[model samples]
Target: MSDNQNLLAEQRRALILDEVRRRGGVRVNELTRKLNVSDMTVRRDLDALARQGVIEKVHGGAVPVVEASTHEPGFEAKSALELTAKEDIARAAAALVQPGSAIALSGGTTTFALAHHLVDVPELTVVTNSTRVADVFHTARQTAGAGGQRSGSPVVVLTGGVRTPSDSLVGPVADQAIRSLHFDVLFLGVHGISVEAGLSTPNIAEAETNRRFMRSARRVVVVADHTKWGTVGLSSFATLDAIDTLVTDSGLSEETRAEIAEHVPGLLVADRATSGSVPGNG
Candidate 1:
């Protein structure tokens, strides 16, 4: 009877895993209802799955584990994670942009979200290593001109380099291109940010390319969600002190925020917005 119960539990947990993956997240109550199991049982199963590193337990439920130091997810894979938090971070970072000033943007889903917010900035010049970032402006420009009207889109300069899994252009070519140009500010979206590792990435070449981006900018601002705080990637790119500001969402606890604030010059938190057009300022 014990062996049979164990087998049944395994099958039930397998269903839970599938549901989490399909919906990106699942609430405990919903799981209990779906599995016709007690709440405690569902919670126990979630604990077991979390311990296996297959799922991450959140406030009231579980979500797919998208965290890793050495393993980097592809652009589309990352695009689905923390979407609302990304938008919040993006709005906060976009507030730092000054019209007519040249700014550099490193590649990441957060930075891609920021690109959308910057499309209408007049006289802005955007220097980026992400093809997706550039395409945002390109699409905006085309749309504005569809009716034979002038568009106030920013001038986008896309760096030349090999593409990474995250849709970022990195390598000697990208580094050289960045070396020749300078920006008023750089909005960097990193794979991880820790007190020890600082800003880091799994790709060495991308790390080097990011370094160049930093060197060419007068100020550096990091945009990341709360989940990125404790993560440490394989390659360290910049120290915490090197960044001028950090923009994150309210999901971060006060204690963690206080601790991080001690290291960086400025820390800005974006409250979750009701819609995508959240307003923020530097």
Candidate 2:
């Protein structure tokens, strides 16, 4: 069974809450479809949620514990939040990319923002898995030309492979290409982070490849917003110990922070938005 189906009780409850918040009511079909779990497994999940008063069980679905329109936010609905957090994290992360550095920007809104920030920095090369990020770098080069600037834009390499539903390029081809390069740093976007489950995501193929990326890189810095905390997804490819630093929003709970600190041992936690004083910051 997937971790999403058998997560620790807290992680499972957090997912249920996020689901109800995203989709309002949860029907057996909807839960099974979105989570990629079996119908029986979803029912068991719904039953557990209902027993905790976390949801109201209907004949064929479950409603929110609270009365509200729990509609899933569309991509546009999430854009503003994505932009703000990404900007903060990107700024803090960008300072680490020194001249002559070669780095990989994983496919994610956060890394996409980092690409935009790199426009002014000179003498760096970037490998990426996001088409949108590649376009940004290309545009930045044109902007440089129009301004009569001689500084070259960072080399942008886009991974070629099958695109996932979430718009990430993954699998053997992309992974092999990534393996060919040595990077000073790898900035990654993540779906879920748990103390025991490590770093989990919904796609198995991407998870497998990200595991390899973590192994290949000299440093792996995970960038995520507060929403990922306490959640568990379908696949786990790396452990907390594998991460060098975690940049997230300031909204995380102290308990969650403490658990992660205990698990990752020497992990550094930075609230990208505030206290820009990251661990080891001068």
Candidate 3:
């Protein structure tokens, strides 16, 4: 195929994957009409994606691979899911940050969202293991400088370590960096939060790095959406009592909320409407 044809084919496959992810499944005829491509072209794209394990090609179309709760999705995939809930949780988590306070943020999609919400807060010393979170601050600073103001940018320290599939920096390097720092608060984003397991993650290296983050901070605040309620990952980071507070969305069930409250009394369930206010205790 020509270079132009190959590029078009790649773009078509991306669109197909996105559609499947959004709708849970997609039909070949639907893709053909939407992408304005031939039926054979759609089939070929789906077949290629299926070979790569991105999707499962059924009789006519494709379906997203069902990832287990213990399995960690890539940054883009996780970011696309629970967007509104993550934003609401992030807004509530951002409210906890005081000006000139030093904070440590663990790497996760929810914490990444928190970084965007925190750009306006001046004089913050943010130490994080996520390169994406660091980039957010960097972009904010550049944008501010371009607009003739550079003083509002926070000091972002990106820890050096091995990058994970979720775009988190982990391993010994990250742990050592976090150990040298002390923060007012540590906002953690985990793969799962349960009354029994507390905070859990899929990767052992990330779990260890998160442990260092918790110890480096005076207070530990967990930022997670409702979907993380009962799902447990491969490794546990912190238990229930170790967390000072939890900022989550209102989509969490009342029964689960009540149960979690027993363990964490300072749970803040963020309402989706009106900038997410924290209801006293769950």
Candidate 4:
């Protein structure tokens, strides 16, 4: 094909993929009309993307690849899925924090919830990669000052790096920033956890950054809801034995709990009560 024709083809394919991502799926006829291309051309573009494994070609059209468990959802979407369970787990994890301690928290909705619970803890130095998590501590400091509370605010250190779809900063910048510091404990939020795969995340960059957090901390505490038990993501951050503790809600199955117990010696189940307090097995 001529250079001009090749450029046009590439642009058309880009548009088709973008449409498929935005709408979840797109018909060949729709792409033809939208891109002012022939039906055969649309089909050719779909076929090309399918060959690259970027999209799945269905009977009528194309859809994004089926990677539900490996797909990283945005903060709002994840926060809405397991509200109570995450909150309970966060409460349980927060109870492990001691005053005048330095802690590291990786990015995830569950760990973001844990940040809220740590607001009142005095004399804590928190290092995190989530912009939302940093904002939570920043707001708490502002609120405490407004109320004229004498207790010192928690120190928050936000690492800089490339932002992912989940609003986590990860990459070389974040890894370098964390290497110079040390934390007493590290609270990691993962997309999935299993006996075989251990703690995993959908984003490779986030996985690399999480490993740095583990290296900088003495104790590694994984905070995740029960839904994350069977799911496995694109990258595994830590093995079961490397984790010091696993904090999760009681919704985890008995069989799964038993299996996890064999790997994680310290597993805490957060049980929610009618009084709105979270109790942990500890």
Off by over 4 Å in 4: 1-70, 145-150, 274-282
What Cα-based lDDT does every candidate model obtain?
Answer: 0.84, 0.68, 0.83, 0.82
Error of 1 at 249 (Å): 0.6
Residue pairs in steric clash, candidate 3?
A: none
Q: What is the lDDT of residue 38 in candidate 1?
A: 95
Tens-digit lDDT track of model 3 for 1-282 = 875675556546756775686578999999999989899988988888777666898888888876564688789878876666788788888898999999988888999999999998988989999988998988887776567546756888999999998899999999898898999999999988777787898898899999999988999999987667666788998898898888987666566677778888698887654556667484
Model 2 bad stretches (over 4 Å): 1-82, 146-150, 265-275, 278-282
Q: How much is the lDDT of residue 9 in candidate 3?
A: 67
Which scores higher on lDDT, 2 or 3?
3
lDDT by residue (tens digit), candidate 2, 118-208: 8777777888777777888888777766765356558778888778655668899888888878888888887677776788877778887
- lDDT tens digits, residue span 167-277, model 1: 999999999999999999999999988888999999999999999999999999999977677667889989999988888876565666777877887888875434332
Better of 1 and 4 by lDDT: 1
Predicted candidate 4 versus true structure: per-residue lDDT over 34-111, tens digit per residue: 888799989998998787666899998998875655688788877776566788788889989999999998898999
Give the range where candidate 2 is weakest over 10 consecutive residues by summed lDDT: 67-76
